[model samples]
Target: MLNIALAQLNYTVGDFSANTTAIISHMRRAAAASADIAVFSELAICGYYPGDLLEDSSFLARCDAALDEIIRTSAELPELVTVVGTARRNNGPGKPLHNSLLAIRNGQIIAEYYKQLLPTYGIFDEYRHFEPGPQTACTLSVREHRVGFMICEDGWNQPGLDYKVNPFDALKQATPELVISINASPSDIGKRKKRHSTISKACQETQLPILFVNQTGGQDQLVFDGASFAVTPDQGVVFEASQFEEDFQCIGFDAGAFMKDGLPLLASALVDLPVEEFTRRQILLGLRDYARRCGFSKVVVGSSGGIDSALTLALAAQALGAENVIAITMPSVWSSEGSVSDSVDLCKNLGIRLHTHPVADLVKQFSTGFEHSFDTPLRGLPLENLQARIRGTILMEYSNSFGALLLTTGNKSEISVGYCTLYGDTNGGLGLIGDLYKTEVYALSRHINQQAGRELIPEPIISKPPSAELAPDQKDTDSLPPYEVQDEILKWHLEGDRMPPAEAKAARNHVQGLQTSEEGRQLVARILAMVARNEYKRRQAPPLIRVRSRAFGSGRQMPLAAKY
Candidate 1:
């Protein structure tokens, strides 16, 4: 009988001391649990996506030392085995390094396995630093049970989409009683569902019980949700760890059965989180990590009493306590009474401070100066944009004076076209809701109200007709398509088939409907043209927390000066 512990942990890239301390601490915890072996996620020693840092000899040396420390620490646990992930020098390979797994028992390295696949697609560039390890199965004996090993991308070959070798198949040839796979998988809209389906299918195909461990943390533009799970060939997934948080749990494996307390638990209990809850947890973790990592304790949002800023402030307050979030209401001549009053009510409900900073006088001054200097009246789109810039400048002043991180509040619908002004409302250090569509903004707003069981964000803010409030009696529909229509079109244009299957199909159908007539087709054409023209503006926008499969920054890379 062998009890295995899966340690889902968070590590900072290039911070070896912290990583080592965390690993060693977890190892001790597993020991206290009377576990025979403890497994860590991929690249647990140096953290995942070290990027070009792997190319530096000094960084590799530090990792080696960290590994050595782990090895020495394993000596004390004479009855336990430690399996960890780290990079090793490929002295006889095409690349300078190899992503490898090590098994240490009684202060000795008993077995080693190098990753067979090096993914080189979207947000991953392992091929640039590490060569492919040998295409062979690795197995080790623990308490008379044969166990197999595979890294993140190795076992993914079961899909047969990109790679040639199926690591699971190679490992199955060994016929080990259980397989252990370590991963650093990032979370997106439907990634958890995809992993469950794909890995469960692989388990059925190979007829091998598998223990999958994943890393947990927010690493700039990427958030790894450590939903480590266990699956059997007959029962699919029997157990799962926490999502979007760190976990350490031990399960006993005895006589070909996984134990919950002391007996086996059915694998039918596996289930995925609802998409809404998934998005909520992802953004919360992403924002919390970003704020902590970037050294900001307070966040400042320029709240216009609009849904965008309302949702942004709500999320920020949730992630970083209400005391840490400050709301600034910037009302203009065109701003409605509710714009200020609703913001006041919203802040009061959230228990956050609300500072009123009206920008109508500043807008008039900028307009007068522009007319005097440029020799023409500053009216139309330019004047409307001036109001946003003045509000943006005031927000920046607050940020600079008090060291609060400015948060931008534009949603995906506005970001899709050129609806937002650069350096104006876009002057945030980080954006919390840039990836959510305007339609989703309302959905999440309602969800938040439902979750709170009261009006955290005043009902007027969510129910009010959308507006920029830059001009008199203005509504967003005055210049653009309705959000219901625009967001669907934007989804079809920006994400296409990458969105969730249902959303993608609906989006395509909507676009198809819009193309049945000349007017509809012309509207689609105009929106697409605006998107093409606004690439430069998006290029300069602040980094927004990514919560979708195809976000603007790193997920979708488009040419700025290219033709439509």
Candidate 2:
């Protein structure tokens, strides 16, 4: 029987001290548990996806020192085999470094394998730094059991996929009893389900039981959900770890079946989290980690009493304690009485402090200065944008005075169509809901209330129509289509086939129907043009917590100078 320990940890980029300490602690724990093998996620020594940091000679030197320390520590636990991921220098290679996995026992490196598949797609640019390993399978013998190893993207290239070579096919030829795949997979909507389906398919094809280990925690725009698991050819996923948090588990492999304690384990399906709940957890973790890592305990938000700001404030309050969140109501002459009152109510419900900072006088001052200098009345779009800019400036001032991060409130719909003013509503350190559609912003707000069992977001705020309150009777619909219609068009245009199956089908059907009529066709063309033209604005916006398949920041790249 082979007892394997799975260590699912959260590693911060460039923090070598903390990453090495965590790995060694987990290694000691695995030894105390009397396990045959202890496995950690990819790049546990230096953290995953260090980006351009890989180019620094000092950073590579630090990585080497950390690996050496881990190797020396393994001597104390000679009976336990430790598997870890780190970067290694490639003397003869295309790139200067190789993404490598090392198996250590008794202070010696027994087996070392370089990752063959370096993904260069969305949110991944592995090919930029690390040279791909030659197409070969790496296996090691442990206590009469043969175990194969593969990195994150290697196991992903199952049959009929995009990659030229299938790493799993090479592994099957070697005929190991089980496979151990280390991953740094980032989380998104429906991604956990896709992982299960893909890994299970690989087990069936290779007729090999597999142990998949992944890292947990937020890394800027990417959040990794550590839902590690063990899958058998006959039972699929039998033993699974936790999601959205750190977890560790030890299971037995005996007679070709997984065992917990001593008995055969029953296969259980991964329960799918509700869409709103998944989004809530993802954003909360994202905000918490982003703020903590950036060295801020508090956050400030511009609460316009609109759905977007209301939701952003509520989430910020939840993520960084209500006491750490401050809401500023920057109302102008165009702002409604309900705007201020609703913000007050929302803050009261959330137990957050609210400050009223009127911007009417400030807007008047700006208009006077502009008219005097430019000899033109500050009217129409400029005036409307002036209000937003004033509010954004006030929020930034609060953030500066309080040493707190400013949170931007624009949602995906407005962000996609260039509806937001540059340097106006976009002034913040981070965006809380930039990936969410206007429709999703409302749905998640309601879900928060339902989960709290009270009106945490204020019922009036939820019931009110969304508006920037920058002009008289300014509804979002005056500029763009209703959120329900616009969001569908965005899903079809922005994400396309990358969306989940149900959403992709729905978007395709919606766009196909829209193309049936001339007016509908014109509207579709206009939205597409708006999205294309807004690349410059989005390029300048702060990075948001990515909850969908294709968010505006890192996932979707477009040329600002080009027209389609």
Candidate 3:
């Protein structure tokens, strides 16, 4: 019988000591459970997305030292074999590195399997730092079974894809009875279902039981929702792990069969929660990990009583606990009583501390200083932006005084159109929901209230028309296309990169006869133009946690001066 343990835990980039400590704790647990082998996720030692840190020799040396220490410690546990991911320097001339999964047995490095395919698209730029391994598979003798190893991107390909060298093709030589895939795959809606289906098909074809282990928690803008599992050769799941959490589970297999001894496999159908539940869980995980990894216990957010700020407060409260989350409502002369009441009630419902700081007096004080210099009154974008900047200043002051991290709340729709004020609404240390579209924001809000069985967000906050309230009665529709219409165009133009002709036809169809005028086409064209022009603003924005296939970070690169 082969007892295997999946170690799904959080890791921080470049923090070798902390990562090693996590690995050691899991190893001890697996040893106590008497598991024959324990598998950890990709880059479990160095943390995934190390980015430019891989170029530092000292950093690499520290990682190597950590690995040496881990190997030395593992030697004491003779009953357990460990397979975990780390960065390894190539022996060849010139500095070539590889993302490797090393097998340690009896306190010595027994074998290593390098990643053959380094992902280059989207959030992954592995090819920039690591050289691809030779097309081959490594098999280890563990618990009287031949066990094969594959990394995150290795198991994602079909057998004969041209762009990648499939690990399955390499597995022909080893013909192992069992396979273990270590991954640091990021979370997206419905991604787990697709991943499970792929793993099951691979196991069925190879007739080998497969154990898939993934990392949990967030790293910068990426969140790894661990839903690790093991599947039998017959496509039946043997064991399933939890999502958005750190967990360790052990499963026993005998001769390519899951050993179920009277006890049923601890498994359930994959979660298919409402989009709100998914978003809430994602944001909570993102916030919690950001704080834990960055060494911050408390968070501060500027509550504008808008949907964006309200949702941000909800997520922060869920993640850092009500006691740890602090909300500041900075209202100006334009701010309405309803806005203040709604924000206060929302905070009360969530049990968070609310601080009200009226900015009307401060605005007047600042305006008096500039009154002499400017002949005309500041009534355009400058006036609106000053209000946002004042609120930002107040939030940052609290953050600096208390050593708390400020979470920014701006959705993708507004971000794409450059609707946000730089150094104002975008002044936070991290952008929590920057990847979510505006429509998605409302959807998630509705989901949150539904889950609570009562209104957590005030009724006016939901039913009332969406507005920024930056100026007198400023509604979102006054400046841009409706969110439903805009989001469709964005998905097609930004994601699909469709041509103007195609995009125009799509926009027309989406808006039906409402936006068919030539003037409307010009407006749509202008919106797309603004998105293309504001790439620089997004480039400077705080790292946004990704929950989609395409995000506005390392993945979406656009030339600053290029016309396209």
Candidate 4:
């Protein structure tokens, strides 16, 4: 019988001391469990996807030292084997390093495997720093059981995939009793289901039980949902760790079947989180980690009393306690009474402090200066945008004065069409809902209210017509299509094939139906042009928590100066 301890941990990028401490603490816990092997996620030594930090010799040296420390600690627990991921110097390679894994026992490196697949696709740029390892399988004899190793992307090539070499094929030749894959997989809508299906297919094909380990944390815009799981050839997924949180648990492997408490483990079905609930948990974790990592206990959001700002403030208050979340309402002359009142009610419901800052005087000052300097009155679209900028500046002032992180509240629908002013509403340290569509913002707000069993976001804020309140009687529909129509177009235009199968099909059908008429055709063309024209604005916006497969950041890179 082989007992395997799975450590689903959260690590900060480039923080070697903290990372090492976490690894060692988990290793000690695994020892207490009397496990044969302890496994950590990919790049646990220095965190995953360090980007250009791999270029620093000092960083690489520290990574090496961290590995040495883990190895030395293993000497104390001579009977336990520890598997960890780190970067190693590659002597003969295109890149300077290799994403390597080390197996330590009794203060000695027994087995080392370099990751064969260096994914360069969306949200992954492994090829920029590390060369792909040789097409060979790495295995070791552990407690009389043969175990094989693969990194994140190695086992993804089951069949009919694009990769040139199949790492699993090499592993099949090695004929190990079990396969262990370490991953730093990021979470998105329907990603958990995709991971189980893909890995289960590979397990059945190879007829080898596999243990998949993943990390949990919010790294920039990406949040890795640590649903580390174990799969057998007969039973697809037998066990899974916690989602959106750090977890550690040990399972017994005996006679090629997983066991818990000395009995055969039953196949556990994956309970996929509802779309709105999934997005809520994802954004909460993302904001909490972003705030903690950036050294801010409090966050300030410019609450416009619209669905987007109300949702942002509610989520912020939940993530960082109510005391740590501050809402600033910057109402202008064009702002409605309901806007200020709704913000007040929302903050009261959330138990957070709300500050009202009127921006009418500030707008007048900026408008007077702009008209005097440029000999052109700041009116029409320019005047409307000035109000937004004034609000953005006031929010920033609170952020600076109170040492709080500013949260931008523009949703995907507005951002795609450039409805948001560049320096005005887009100012913030981090965007909590920038990736969510305006339609989704409402859905999640309702979900939050339902979960709380009360009007957490307030009924008026949820029922009110969407507007920027930058002009008299201005509604978002004045300049853009209704959210339901605009979101479909944005999804079809922005994400397309990257979206989940159901959503993609729905979006495609909606767009195709719209194209059947000349008016709809014109609307589609106009929205597409707006999205293309607004690329410069998105390029300058702060990073938002990514909840979908194709977020605006690194996942979708479009040239700003190009035209179709």
Candidate 5:
């Protein structure tokens, strides 16, 4: 029997000391548990997805030193073998370095395996730094069992998305008893389920029981949900780790079956989380990690008593204790009584602090200055935008004075069509709801209240119509289609086939129904024009937590000066 310990750790990008220490700690824990081999996620020594940091010689030097230390540290547990991901110089390659997996035992580097597949699509840009490794399979014999290894993207090349290799096939040719794959896979909606299906398919093709280990925690826009698992042709995901958090598990393998504590894993543990719940957990973890890593323990949100800000504040309070969340209500002349009162009730219900920072004076000052300087009264779109800008400026002042992170509250609907003012509501260090549509924002707010078992977001905040309150009685519907219709159009336009299967189909049908008439076609054209014109605005927005398959930023890139 081979006892394998999988370490799903949360690592800091480019912090070699912290990353190395974390790896060593997990190695020691696995050794103490009498594990035959301890496996870490891809790029554990220096963290995964370092982007241009990998190009720095000093960073790689630190990684080399850290790797040497880890090799020496493995000596403390003489019987345990360690497999970890790090980078090494490719002295004779197409690229300057190789993304390598190191195996160390008893203070010696036994074998080194370089990643053959460099993913360059979507949020991945591995090809920019590292060259592909050799085509040979790596296997190490331990406890009378032959184990194989593959990096994150090596085993993902299927018939549809064909790369130059099929790593599992080569590894299977070696007749290994099992395969262990380390990954730094980022999480999104339905990612865990898709990962399981892909890995299970590989197991069936190779007929090899496989152990998959992944990294956890947030790295800016990307969040890795460490839902690692063990799969076999017969059982398919027999043992699984935790999701959206750090986890470590040791499983046993004998005669092609995986057992946790010498027994089969429960079937109930293999189910997928509900997609909404998955999104909620991902956002919470992403927000917490982003704030923690950026050195801010507190967050300040401009609460407008709307669904977007209400949900953002509620999620913030939940992620980083209620005491750490501060809500600033900057009500203007156009703001309704329910706006400030609902915000007050929401803060009280959430046990968070609330401050009134009325922006009517700021709005008036900006309007007067604009009319004087330009010789034209700032009204219509410009005036509405001034109100938003005033509120944004006040919130920034709070962020500056308190040293708390400012959280932007614009949802995907507003963000897509440029409904948000550039320097106004977009003046946050980070955003919590930028990836969510207006419809999803309402759904998540309801979910939060349901989970809280009380009206934590205030009933008025949940029930009230969504508006910027920048102008008198201004509602979002006056400018854009109802969210029920606009969100479907957005899903069809922005995401296309990349959205949820059912959602994409429904959205396509809804968009077609809208396009059947001249008015519907004109509405679609208008929304498209706005989305295209707003690229400059989105480019200036701060990093937001990504929850969907096709989010803004790196997941969806658009040319600022181009027309399609």
Candidate 6:
């Protein structure tokens, strides 16, 4: 019998000592549990997706030092072997590095396996950072059984995609009885299902039990949902860890019982929950992990009584508890009574503390100073932006005084078309829903209401037409395309990277209730242009939690000053 422990931990970028301490503590606990081996997620020593930090030799030295500490401490546990991911010097020519997994037993480095495949496209620029490893597998004897090891990208083998190497193929040559894979895979819609299918197929084909460990938590724009599991030789899942939490679990494998023709069954089929529940859980996980990893306990958001802010507050309350969520409503002359009532009711429903600060006096006071200099009326864009800036200043002040992080509440659709006020509504420590479209925001809001079995978001907030209310009787449709139309264009132009003009015309023709007029085409072109122009704004914005396949940060890199 072989007892193995899987450590699914959360790591922060550039925090070397804290990460080392976490790994050592988990190893000691696993040893106390009498586990023969403990496996950690990919890049566990240094945070995964360490983007440009790999270029710093000093940072790399610190990582090496931390690894040395772990090696020295492991001498205390002679019976336990620890496997973890780290960046190692290639020792070839100039500055070559490899993403590697090191095996330590009895305080000595036993075996090392480099990553065979380095992904380059769409959210991964591994090819630009580390050299690919030779196509080989490392086999070690643990608990008298030969175990094979592989990195995250090695297991994925779909052709036509970059990094198409399959670890199982190499493992077949060694014919190891068991295999372990360390991963830092990010979360996407329906990603867990695809991962499960891949693991199940590998076990069924190789007849070797497999243990897959994944990292959990948000690192900058990337969010890792740790749903680690172990599959039996017969393809049955013997143990499954919880998603979005740091956890350690031990599984015992019976080597003698699985040589014959027996099938491993899945531990259980994934629970069929409502789509809203899944998204809610994901958002909560993203929020909680980002805050905790960054050492924050409380969050503050500017509530405009709009759907975006309402959804953000709900998710924040769920993540940090109602006590830790603070909502500040900054109302101006343009703000309606309905907006105030809705904002108050929503806060009451969520049991979160609310503060009201009318910004009319502040706006008047600031504009009074400029009244003589400007002959034009202050009722145009300047006044609208003034209101948003006042709200931003007030929210930021509270955040600084209370030592709480401020959460931005702009949806993707608004962000894509440059509908948001830079340094105004966009001022926050993190953009909670920056990747979600306006349509998705509404869907998620309805989902939340249904889950609560009561109208947590008031009916007026849902049924009423969407508006920024920056100016009197200002509706979103007045200045921009409808959300459904705008979201489709965004998906095509941004997500699909399709030609805007051609794709917009095609989309207009295919979409129901959409006008295929020249006006619509111009609208699409204008929005796309804004998305392109606002690259600098997004570059300076706070780190956003990525929930989509292609987010504005890291994955999509646009030139700061580009013509096209």
User: For model 3, what is the error of residue 299's alpha carbon versus the real structure, in angstroms, after optimal superposition?
Assistant: 1.3
In order, candidate lDDTs are 0.88, 0.91, 0.83, 0.92, 0.88, 0.82
For residue 418, model 4's alpha carbon misses the true position, in angstroms, by 0.9
After superposition, candidate 5 runs with Cα above 4 Å error = 266-269
Q: List the residue pairs that clash in candidate 6.
A: 234-264, 236-264, 236-265
- TM for candidate 3 is 0.93
Clashes of each: 1, 0, 1, 0, 0, 3
Quote the lDDT for 137 in model 3.
87
Residues 404-498, candidate 4: write the lDDT tens digits.
Answer: 99999989988889989999999998999989998899999999999999999999998888888888898889989888998999999888988
Predict model 4's lDDT versus the native: 0.92
44 in model 4: Cα distance from truth in Å?
A: 0.2
Q: Give candidate 3 misplaced runs (Cα > 4 Å).
A: 93-95, 162-164, 236-238, 260-268, 496-523
Candidate of highest lDDT: 4
Model 5 lDDT per residue over 1-564, tens place: 888888999999988888888899999999999999999989898888888998888888898899999988989999999999998889894999899988899999887899999988778889899999999899999989988888989978854266868777688789999888889999987678788888888888879988889999999999999989889898787778888889888888888888888886644556677766787898999999899889999999988888888899889988999999999998889889998889988899989999998888878888899889999998998888888887888888888999999999888989999988999999998888898988888888888888879898887777777788888888888888899989999999988887767878999999999999999999999999999999999999999899988889998889999977
lDDT of 2 at 250: 89
User: Which of the two, 2 or 3, has more TM-score?
Assistant: 2
TM-score of each: 0.96, 0.99, 0.93, 0.99, 0.98, 0.89
Please list all clashing residue pairs in model 2, or write none if there are none: none
For 1-564, candidate 1 gives per-residue lDDT tens digits of 789989999988888999999999998899899888899989999999898899788998999999999999999987788989999888894998889998888899998999989987666789989989887899999989999998988877776777887787778789999888989998888788778878889888998888899999888778899999988878878888999999999998866577888889686655667666777788888888888778889999998889999999999999999999999998888999989998988899999999988787888888889889999999989898888888899999999999999999988889889799998998998887888899888988888888889989888898889999999999999999889999989999988887779989999999999999999999999999999999998999988877788888877788998997
Quality of model 6 by C-alpha lDDT: 0.82
TM-score of 4: 0.99
